[model samples]
Target: MAKPMRRLMNPALFICDLQEKFRPAIYEYPKVIATTQKMLKACKILNIPVFATTQNKSRLGETCEELGLDSPDGISTKVHADKTAFSMWTPEVRKAFADLPPTTPPTAKRECIIVGIESHICVTQTTLDLLREGHKVYVLADGVSSCNREEVPIALARLRAEGAVVTTSESWMYECMGDAGIQEFKEIAKLVKETKDSTQQSLQTLCKI
Candidate 1:
């Protein structure tokens, strides 16, 4: 296996097309949002950079409220990029990276942690593009979904075959934590606890395929 990512301090998170209108079609919408929320909280504690994309927000509506992706001030650690493109590697997203704090190296790019809706389309395209650009992509399977249940498994299988590391939100968070001694361990532990019940019910369905 490849050496696992332990770069939580400056990690990058890509949340794609998790809009309100997109919810009805997504399987296990509640659990996906719950797991994603847990992941986001962990990212905040670790100061992981976040880039969120909304596909045609005019029609799809904004990102769902459960995730707290909206901050009216247009100022927050979570950067929002509005786009019509399927691949979120749009200019806005690129600019988000460019706008990262000086703590981030201008030369080297870290692995991108990906999550969000419609696994077979935008999520898949973005994952492939990032991989093509030599960025290791880790897609959080439990946090990704498709309107057509069958398509998710197919897309995930293809993503894995293409060398994208497929994993669950919990596993990735624990990997990032690396130890129980970290001060943030308590918050992360609580977040993990809250999500386990509902998340497991959905993961059973998502992972079985």
Candidate 2:
């Protein structure tokens, strides 16, 4: 008898409108950035491609420099775009998505992990659009926020209802890694340890009601 084929995950990171201008307005914005930084570091270790967007960069400013979206060694940025639309799923991003190598054996759908600002708007729309495109979406609870903290939970609940998996950054990282035996496990483990304090603080601040 033939053995069943192993499933594979082709995942990408989506950073939505975590720009400089909104840092002062978004609730717990620092915590959001901290969580996103952790994810970006993990993505670098795991070799996952990253796509980032800014909402009208002319007015909103660029994605926070601290995330290092432009640094080749910091994050594997496939497309860093500026958009007027609420969704990060713009034409440029779509084209970049199309250009990615197909999943091995072509059977697994891509998985998108999102982290960013204004959970009720850009993040929510991005999640919905990705779901519509037949991709599995995971929105990091600790990596998303809004001007009003109240909006965060509501947006998360709606996305969860809409089929997106609402999970924390650490949980999603492990889920993506899937095994301690993988080659990147040691590095990831170290990252988790190094960011322990910050992670806990971020969770408490960003996930609190």
Candidate 3:
């Protein structure tokens, strides 16, 4: 089982294969993008380090603007790693992890909260690798998707079976926030509201279809 996250300490947000060209190919792409933004907002408020990867930028294109790797919401502390391997543990990704933000102590035990595309492939592979390397891994359900809807749940269950905690974006956000009295609660709450609003809009858009 993945270790319970009690506080927002020594944690990193790892985004994998959230490329642009693949958006249309994935299930619930808009919600995936929105949920990721909410998580990014939480990361910013809590000062969590963010490491993102592009799975072959040339073919897959760059991380979507919604994920904000190119220009984030004042959270300047982001690492954009490029890779070919299905796992984020590849040499290039490792280099990004190696030089974490100065605020994060190198010796502290690291827990990674992950999100991204192709839950059956890249996301699953990366989660498995993180677990093997002794990092507590949590996969955000709403933040990851696949080309096939059926495969998404299967991949999430498989990750959970392999010891990675399967959670939703809101669930993880509040868990990390801990209590409403904490400083970032308002910020996260605001972000949550925005996400809800955005999701509502999306649902309406879908209803028109």
Candidate 4:
């Protein structure tokens, strides 16, 4: 049988609800954070716009603390959309997002690459909504998390069935790069190799009974 393939085009980046009080509980917190930062770095180099959404600021606070978005110039905190719905298209969110002032109207909108926590809830709904709105959505699996492992697989299946492309941070990097022959590729390759080495070490330590 032939496997499925996704061809991503003109994708921006969106990160949702990887909040402060909740991040540590996820199965792959460190990998999610590191991979997200790598994606942000790749986006920056590629000149891609990035947006981040938070669930509730009063309870969760900003996304920077959760994602460790510590840049001297700051993490490019656009208007943080606080939402009650899992979907980010609430009135408040729509208003906050409208602060960006698009150069063109609805049909010309750009695609967004999304990542975040609680895969079965906020991440799932937001992606579904985005897809409905005719935006190409790329879900970064390694850059996303759920409170339980079971939710992750379920969320992935739901999103894939709904037309979202499920991809990892490294695959996203190379996909965005399109070729392994650029100067930036060297840095990304080093990062990927390091990540592989770290996973191997962790697995080896686990096997050393």
Candidate 5:
């Protein structure tokens, strides 16, 4: 068994195409999006870098409004990548991530935690490409979804075969920060509580109807 201690996660988060058009088709989009938002908040509080991609925003619309992404000017726009491909290698994609300063030491490439829709398409391709680039790729299993549940498991199997670390949103978040006693812990704890409360409320509503 792989030691849980060895399952270190990346501080950088790469949110893929969780757009409005894309979410309704994915089985766990609501849950995944909620977790992704929490993970994003944790990263932000810890001063970790974050990157996101969208698949042709003109066609699909923006990343789901729930993400609360801020513009470069900090206006909080839902649109991010506006790209054609699944991988963040397009001119637009490259420009967005290229400017982010690494969170770790100067020599270390940024670690990327990827979460998004259609595990077999955008999520799968992006994770593979990042792994190829020598960056640590941590796939947030609970935060990625597909229209078909089977596809997600298959994609995860392939990723594990290729040595990608598969993890959950909560696990990855705590690991990235490494401890809950630091001053920042209280801040992240608040975000985590907010996420849990919101998720429970959403689930309760879904059950009521």
Candidate 6:
């Protein structure tokens, strides 16, 4: 008898405007970077596609160097674009999504997980756009922040009400895998273990109301 195939969620990672220029302005910015690092590692292990954007490279510099979006062996991004639009859901990103090979079920929508800056603006708009297009959006509470920390919770609340899942990076990672019997489970579990301390600290700093 043949073994049944494991069911996996079709997911993508969106790193929105975690640029060099915004580092000092955003609240708990370091914590956000830490969480994004964890997710990027998990994505690499799980072979999930990544998409990244810069708010405006000319003025904002580029996505933080530490995330390693540009290195040959680092996070292999499907789309690393620069956009004037506050939302990361620009034409380039949309085209990339359209170009992805059809999902196993053909009709299954992609799940977009977001981690970035200015929670009330770019992140919020991105979530709304993804939701409008029928894709599931998970806005990581511990992976997003604004210059003003107070905007974080309010933005999350609005996104949640608007149909996005406001969750933590760790929670979304496990949920995306959905089954321990899958081949990547052990590696992912190890990643979760390795990131445990940073995850906890991020939650405490970035998730505060």
Top-scoring candidate (lDDT): 6
- TM-score to native of every candidate shown: 0.87, 0.94, 0.84, 0.75, 0.81, 0.96
lDDT of 4 by residue, 88-163 (tens): 6677656555565462444465566887777788888888888887877888776777777677778888899999
Clashes of 4: 0
* Model 2: lDDT of residue 3: 34
| Shift in Å, residue 196, candidate 3 | 2.0
In terms of lDDT, model 4 sits at 0.67
lDDT of 3 by residue, 37-76 (tens): 7777788788888888888898878788766665735455
lDDT of each: 0.80, 0.89, 0.76, 0.67, 0.70, 0.90
How many clashing residue pairs are found in candidate 6? 0
Clashing pairs in 1: none
Candidate 5 per-residue C-alpha lDDT over 17-101 given as tens digits, one digit per residue, 9 for 90 to 100: 8789976687767877877777777766776666677788888888777677774523232226667877765676566666665
Per-residue CA lDDT of candidate 2, range 1-209, in tens?
Answer: 44333122698999999899998999989999999999988888877899999999999898888998877556658999999999999999999988999885497689899999789999999999999989999999999999999999999999999999999999988888777777788898999999999999988888876
Worst 10 residues of 1 by lDDT: 1-10
Per-residue lDDT value at 181 in model 6: 73
Error of 1 at 144 (Å): 0.5
Q: Give me the overall lDDT of model 1.
A: 0.80
TM-score ranking, best first: 6, 2, 1, 3, 5, 4
Give the CA lDDT, 0 to 100, for residue 89 in model 4. 65
Q: In candidate 4, which residue ranges exceed 4 Å CA deviation?
A: 1-9, 64-74, 91-109, 180-209
User: Candidate 6: deviation at residue 182, Å?
Assistant: 0.8
Show the colliding residue pairs in model 3.
none
Estimate the lDDT of model 2: 0.89
